[model samples]
Target chain A: MPVAIGLEGSANKLGVGIILHPPHQTADPPSPHDSAHSDDEAFSTRTQKHTSPPVQILANLRHTYNSPPGTGFLPKDTAAHHRRWVVRLVKQAMKQAKVQLEDIDCICYTKGPGMGAPLGSVAIAARTLSQLWEKPLVGVNHCVGHIEMGRAITGADNPVVLYVSGGNTQVIAYSAQRYRIFGEALDIAVGNCLDRFARVLNIPNDPAPGYNIEQLAKKGKVLLELPYAVKGMDVSFSGILARVEEMARKLETSQTSGGGPWKDDESGQPITKEDLCFTLQETVYAMLVEITERAMAHVGASQVLVVGGVGCNERLQQMMGMMAAERGGSVFATDERFCIDNGIMIAHAGLIAWRMGFRTPLEESTFTQRFRTDEVLINWRD
Target chain B: MAQPPPQQPLRTLPPPFNTSAESFELIAQGAESLLYRTTFLSPAQPAALKVRPQKTWRHPTLDKRLTRQRVLAEARVLVKLSGEGIVAGGGGRKVKDPKKKNDGGGDNGGVGALRGLVPAVLALDWERGWLVTEWIDGVTVKLGIYQRDLAADEGVLRGLLGRIGRVVGLLHLAGVVHGDLTTSNMMLRPTRTPGTNADAMARAEEERGEVEVEGGLEGDIVLIDFGLATQSVSDEDRAVDLYVLERAFGSTHPKEEGQFDEVLKAYGESMGKPGKVVLRRLEDVRMRGRKKSMLG
Candidate 1:
């Protein structure tokens, strides 16, 4: 078995995981160290056959750096937080997996499309481990990590991936070795919009702003009107964010002036924070579902795999389920353990690449802030 | 949440359509609408019926709102483009050739140049999410390109590409954007004498062979499937519209992709000054990869 350890600190979350890929019975073992192009065809053929043993997650642990209510985490502070805890998390993860330093075959880390400073910190940790342990390194695209992990956990083969996170929102489907983007957010991401709205509303960041909003929204009955912008398959959320922020401000002022709560125009019923949360989720999730459905229709795909932080929202999952069912398909999603930013996905995705003779030399082991999902050649899939 | 029991088979003809379902033939079922081939009033006059089906997943109110808005938007654009001289008899304009009145003359007395280039709207029932238009009798550019092997002849391909560009240019010049600009959305409607269907049909078949060689590319380039069309004149919007078509051409007809430049050249000539700016903006859009960076 080849084991790989992954470290992730793309944002406020810092995760460390250990994964093992069991050896195939009939096939020759993959080269222990990086073997260049000779093994490429054979590796791809093996993957295409789907003959590799099921991946085993030996250990997956995370520590989040939460900001105070009404505030968001900054890159500088988040980087410092990751630097302070990366070593401890890694050691703990290794111990929990009952694996020794010699047992690890590779060290993987998130390579980018995230906060610059945090991504840099995690890359440094990965580099240090690789040099110290004399193991090869594998850099993973954060979004691909999510998609691959989602597929592994849900057993969704060749699904249209709806990857939603604070930094990115995209609807992707695989074609000719690339996870081509079908649609995406044209402005701020859906998760970013919700997180920003949560700040304006002074929502707690204990669990997560998005999670808090989802809870509050459940109690909300009024479906307040908000700007809905769906352009072709893409969506724009900045307008909706601006409109909701203004509404929040008005509600705050009304309460401060002792003028009573804001009332609905037609019903004269007082509006509450819950109502705003409900409206935001309803409108945005609806947009997400619509775009996903469009991509599915265009590609003639039946299965959809929702991944990333926003994928954890029950309401989103429910809405997606409804849409998929209408098309006589089904939706696949994972719990926050895998959906939210995590190291296990990085380990799993990186191991797949490593198995296919991929490696990141120590000198070239670095992270980027603008890596695109489609930039990674998905050789593991058909 | 419990999944709604399996979707009921889609209604063949909901409400208003039920009365005339027997006369209509389903031609295509698009993502948002169902297109039926039928006649308008008389059996000789063919028409297309587009119905926006209600989506069960969407809230009834929202579904109704979107259906009504799209139906009206498409109708409005068609009506505006027709009146502007993009379509023959669109503005009720007289043809330049008095002798060819029954032939549906290709020339309209200068509304904005390209005449008979769009389908004329005959009627609309917004409440029922249906609209009827004069049926275009011809093949789609996609099929025409495939069946004729348009790429085999450089001159013929260029002419066809130029016509596509000119028609789209006029559309943008008239302040409308066909949101989805795939080759399949356009039809190559052959010209004909108004009353001689049989003669026109025979001539069209003969012309198809000649079209493969002579490079005359003679026909009206009629745009269809206005389901996603919008009224927008902004240079950015127009550039994106053209970009969409450019991508569609590359994907659908990779062999002929290099000839798309003729389309842009013709588009530039037809659009004049604004076209120059839009073409320049298109470069920027292409360089930026048509989509904004995913990272915040």
Candidate 2:
């Protein structure tokens, strides 16, 4: 078995995880229709014919930098938070994993497509550890990490992937050894739109802005009119975001002036803040689901695997499940542990690449702020 | 909370069509709509019918809004495009001008020369969510290019690509943007027969030889599926349309990807000045794929 320790601080969250991959086994082709088996069983059986064993998460831990209400985390503060927590988190992860320095095969860290400062902090930490421990360094793509981890956890073989997070929104499918993007958000990401909207409402970002929005949306009964902008397979949310923010400002102004509450046209009832949240969520999620369905039809794939931070929302999952079931397929999702950004995914995905003889030299270990998901060559997959 | 019904959940025709004795031949099933081949008006007139079924998965109100909006949008774009005329070339039968009576007698020379380049809208009921258009007889540009003899000369293929570009330029010139552009959406309609009388002509063409080789890089490029199209004169919209087609063509026809520039070349020449600006904007659009990569 090869053990790898992954350090992830691409954004506000600082995560350190240790993973071990068992030795290769005899090849066993998994049936695509087989979902009766447990996740672990399915994980073990489904591979690209290399018979790669199921991943073992030795340790996974995270510490998020939560900004105050109505404020988003700044890159500088988030980077400082990661810098302060990186060493401690790595030490704790190693101790929790109960592995010695000599037992580690390699060190992994997120390479690109993230906040520059945070990515640099993690890379510096990974580089320092690699030099101290005399282990090779494996650079992993942040998006690819989420995808591989979702596949490992759910065992959804060759399904279309809808990766939604604060930074990214793409509908991807595997083809010709690359995860080709079929559709995506043309402007700001779906999560970013939700987060900014939450800020306008001064929603607490305790667990997450998106999470709070989902909760408030549960009580909202009226679906307010919002601009529906879906062009072909691509969607634009900046327009919708601007419109919602304007509505929020108007609502605030009316309340401060002691004007009558914004009443529902039919019910003649006051529209609460929850109604705005509900409308935003419904409109955006519907756009996401529609594009996802279009991709499914284009590629003729039945199964769908949703990953990233926004994947944790119950309503989004429920909506996706309905769409998948309509196509005679099911949705595969993980809990917050794996759904949100974390280190284990990086470790798991990196180790797979490392085993395939892929390594990032120190000279090429530099990170980028604009690395695309499709740029990564998934040679390990068929 | 509850799951939606599974795929192929007993689809039913909408309204008056459901009561008609005429048989509806299922042509294609897209994500948002089902396409059927059915006769309309007269027994001999063949038409392409697009039905946007109600998605039970969506909220009832949202579903109704989308169905009505899309159906109406498509009908409006088609009607507008059909009104503008392009120079009809090649050996195809002349497009029967619907506005001929409105023009008051004799040919207004080249007026509506490109009338048949897009199928004329026969009828549509937005509330019921279905559209019918005069059927164009022939194969899709996708299959036409796919069936080409690889060993044959590339000249004919390039010519076909140039024509595709020219037609797209004309579409943009008409102040419309085809939201989804792919070889699949462009049809290689046989030009020799009467365009309206598609039923008998299609059969006659098929009997001549393999439909693919019989035309062999010959025919007018007729655009179809206006479900996602919009009325926009912006260069950004036009460039994006070309970009979508470029990406789709690359993925679908990797072998002929290098020749896609022929389409753009023709597009630029056909649309004159505006087309050149759109082509410039296409470079920026290409730099940013579907979305620009930012913070993780």
Query: TM-score of each model's B chain?
Result: 0.77, 0.79
In the range B60-154, model 1's lDDT, one tens digit per residue, is 55667667767776776666556633444544333222321332223233333323566778887777898988898887787777676443567
> How do all models score by TM-score?
0.82, 0.87
Please identify model 1 stretches exceeding 4 Å from their true place: A25-53, A258-260, B1-8, B21-29, B38-40, B43-46, B84-116, B136-164, B187-221, B243-266, B283-296
Clashing pairs in 1: B88-B116
Q: Tens digit of lDDT per residue, candidate 1, span A1-382?
A: 7899998889889999888766662122232222222222223422222343256678888999999999999999999999999999999998888888889999999998788899999999999888898999999999888988888767687899999988889888887677777677766889899999999999998889999999999988777778777665667799999999999999899989977778998788899999899889888998898878766755567799999999999989998998787677899988888889999889988998888889998888888887878789888666
Q: Between which residue pairs do clashes occur in model 2? A: B86-B113, B86-B114, B88-B113, B92-B191
